[model samples]
Target: MAAGAPRIFVSHLSGIAVFDPAGDQVGRVRDLVVMLRVGQRPPRLLGLVVELATRRRIFLPMTRVTAIQSGQVITTGVLNVRRFEQRPTERLVFGELLDRRVTLTETGEEVSVLDLSVHQLPARREWEIDRVFVRKGRKGSAFRRAKGEALTVEWTAVTGFSLEEQGQGAESLLATFEQLRPADLANVLHHLSPKRRAEVAAALDDDRLADVLEELPEDDQIEILGKLKEERAADVLEAMDPDDAADLLGELPTDDQERLLRLMQPGDAADMRRLMSYEDRTAGGLMTTEPIVLRPDATVADALARVRNADLSPALAAQVYVCRPPDETPTGKYLGTVHFQRLLREPPPSLVSSILDRDLQPLDPEAELPAIAGFFATYDMVAAPVVDEAGSLLGAVTVDDVLDHMLPEDWRETEFHLDEEVATDGS
Candidate 1:
């Protein structure tokens, strides 16, 4: 090892392609194997867990790694074909470190470990933990707020935290990720292996899992869904926005979808069936059945109360639907919508119908993707209601869903250019 070796965050090393000295591809890095040692020093990297083209996983000792850089790891063209197994003393970085909560010894505040920086020990073929990037603030409070820069604490400043020691197992480690936005959490989950992803998914509550599942790619969504027990899967599906759940169900084989739907609450099953009835690219298929609804005579105060629901998406909460009797699905009649902004300007006692957007038309449930896009563009609305031939409100399609459909097929894969700029020498 050379002096002043580059310090790379462990996350940057994850998923980078591995190559042999002859320039032949080996396999991508699955995880780092490390052994914890006593004293003030950090754990030592022992080997690389590599998953080959054959779908077989094997171990490549650190001695076989000739070089490591931003986008690839160079090996000496030698590898052990036998499978990699976890030794009693070793810990997998990707499985164990990324989101573990560790208390800051100085502040006595708990922070989630976001990433770990590791570097080669001076003049030796060994790497040890150096710095840790941790996010401050408690869980639920930070989920919706913008997170500031991570506090990079030297490894020694962290103490008395271990999954086994805390007796929380995966739950304690996953608590750190509880504060991440669903989309951000989905991105991190995408990079993990199937097993690790399932472990984390199991740790999340239904609502959080539903939100994250909606953000993940269809294949990933299906994989994680398959891992859950039937009843738990039903609970997660029911918690998801109906449209998102329907979209996911549409991707699975009919028998599996039917089985899972059977386990769901009847009302939720009915809602999903209604969504599944429409063409995937149509407005009905892309709309959520759970928009804030109100009776025509309801007051601004009532509308405001609906807007306060924490589970409602921002777009869905931005307006309230006014209908005749039966505010639930097949909403008795599509009276009109009252923009939340309009409610603010009206007196609290004023009826919602008084400020309704009478001229704002709803989209037909069968409207095609292009028509839906035009509706959003022409009306300058983040969400629009869907109605049946009889003018009964069915659901509301949000701008996020419309944009999701408008994006290219490989949008999610390209969104994170993990290969382009992962590793860099800290200045």
Candidate 2:
């Protein structure tokens, strides 16, 4: 859902049907998954536990939720079907939070949590528990119908639910490291004991883990992925960039790779299979399957919107590939590219085809790492489209991926020291 979406109570969401973009019922909401913050700050609403028709529950990230209507949750139709497993840092709203007693900060009165309200943050996809609907005093006895005072208070007005500053285990550590960048977090995780590393990895949400995994050494990536349950591992892999995920998958034994691939969405699995087919250092292998693709008829406005997606890396967002029908990867005949800068110069209503950069030769799928690196350097381009022999747009190879392949394998393992004072400094 977009930012400023209406607040929704936990009670109202219970058992609500979740539908896809096509209005087909996919599942029912079972519970909410949230991670408690370090202080009185509201817990981030990670996602929902949705039980499907077969009674298998899966995690539905808030990012995938397009809209939340009364008694209905509409998804973007993209879902990770692996069974939901609670992480060390996650809490279940129904299973653990409801009816629990917490102290109200105002009058120091202990209140029972009847419900909690969550709202999407402005200009972001994040959702947080903003308010608590609670009842003061104990529940009424069965014989005498005694009702306690009911009140709704800000989440900060409650003293419980936050992670303890001195708390033990990964939950507290996660809260402390919540703001760390993926690369920085990977560095921290690399130095931790294997056991502690596993604990922290298991506690991270799929997206966070995926990003960190991409930044970690190959050995650490294998070790951590092996520690997770097969289903959860599959979920994390699904969350990763297609090129990164394929690389990780390639390191696994054939049997293990096939198993995880079987668990992934068919389209995602297809992408993985396609990427795995090319030589590891080739343009096809380094290209990300998902790129900003637009049709000839698309306007500059449409291309700009795709380029604005937060999930895309800077390299990938640098330009968009214009193609024929089948806008997805391995799309119909490749047309040309439209750079982000060019799009800015055109009117919003102008068709992207008018300003296409047709002169630049797209990367060949079989182009070796050396050729890929040279192309980026020669053109001073951050990204280039990969087209097949049939002139179909395959995907886009990014400069970062080219550099990754060209760098020494041990480069990521090089240890660098940070000043103790600077390391501890946070402002």
Candidate 3:
């Protein structure tokens, strides 16, 4: 909780009233609006948008916030309280200037504001805004004319408000990950700043963190890990699939990688290190150590019980591997896999072998990328088991790792991508 950061009780928000410095009751707070500022020590609070009488709304500068009490917001100055000038074109609070025309200093060309992003100065309380978007207007315009010139103001150009002037005590109404689906969380993460993202990640428990991390791209995983403390990072990594942990650790510098590994429990670190020893593109590199394995002679009821009781990873495939007795060498004898969906559709007393798919195609530890890809392409496999030459089940790889190799870089630009556009509106 750095100084000047809004102290609104985000979790306990409800029935919180907002008042101006003049002590006039404006309205109850509907939500606390926030803007993400990357690389900033403490992310900036752009302003607070309050819901007022008759569905009216007003944007109050963060500067006017005075105090954030349990049930009310206190402002340092009186707000106009009149209905805000409607700007439906600027529906999004972020990059509000997008689509508006502005003049570029060097090129002297009129460009449509496509996006606005925030960049924070490390170790400082300040933020710089960046704008990005496609250019509009004639090619040779000496002086570019700004569309809606009044709204093209840069972030720095506005300086009338003070830290305490923004209406204080309004709470954030955004849903937590537990409250949102994974796809929804993905969408929200795209909109948040790095610092804000860390806050959101910190809120998740190890289980949820594991689920979310698997869904994020490798680059995003690295970015998020870079922002977290070593302890928190270790917690997240340890909870993830072993192969994912190895991949993420491999992305960091030598010192950072070692430091994080040291922070992990010995068992967890050893497993990750073993996985890291394999080439990243190989089957050995992508396999997870925690595959669901059971004895080949086990009854379907027994196997089903284990599946129900086991704390399976979120990335678990629909099938459970069955091996012969002496579980350690089950992959050697190669019993087969029981498709969970199929088992549920059959009688409970059926033998495991009756439901097993014996024609499974296994991957050798030393298999090359092209061979691995072709195996998946030929069989339409969702996951494949990796085995040693002796047929010992070493681990298993899912389709996700292979897909990562095929995707292009920069497929999804982060919310921070628009930082330049927002910065252009400097004081």
lDDT for model 2 comes to 0.86
lDDT of 2 at 138: 89
Write down the RMSD of all candidates, one decimal each: 16.3, 18.5, 17.2
Candidate 3 lDDT over residue span 323-415, tens digit each: 665564224466677877777887878888778886877898788778888998998777788877776777777776777655555433322
TM-scores for the candidates: 0.60, 0.59, 0.56
**Which one wins by TM-score: 1 or 2?**
1
True-structure lDDT of candidate 1:
0.80
TM-score of candidate 1 versus the correct structure, residues matched by position: 0.60
Q: Tens digits of per-residue lDDT for model 2 on 118-211?
A: 9999987778999988887785321133378888899999987775544468887889788778886886677566777898999999999999
lDDT, candidate 2, at 255: 99
Q: Which residue window of length 10 is worst by lDDT in model 2?
A: 418-427
Better of 2 and 3 by lDDT: 2
For 188-234, candidate 1 gives per-residue lDDT tens digits of: 67755566678889988898899899999888999999999989999
The CA lDDT at 95 in model 3 is: 28
> Candidate 1 vs candidate 3: which has greater lDDT?
1
List the candidate 2 regions with Cα displacement exceeding 4 Å.
1-167, 415-427
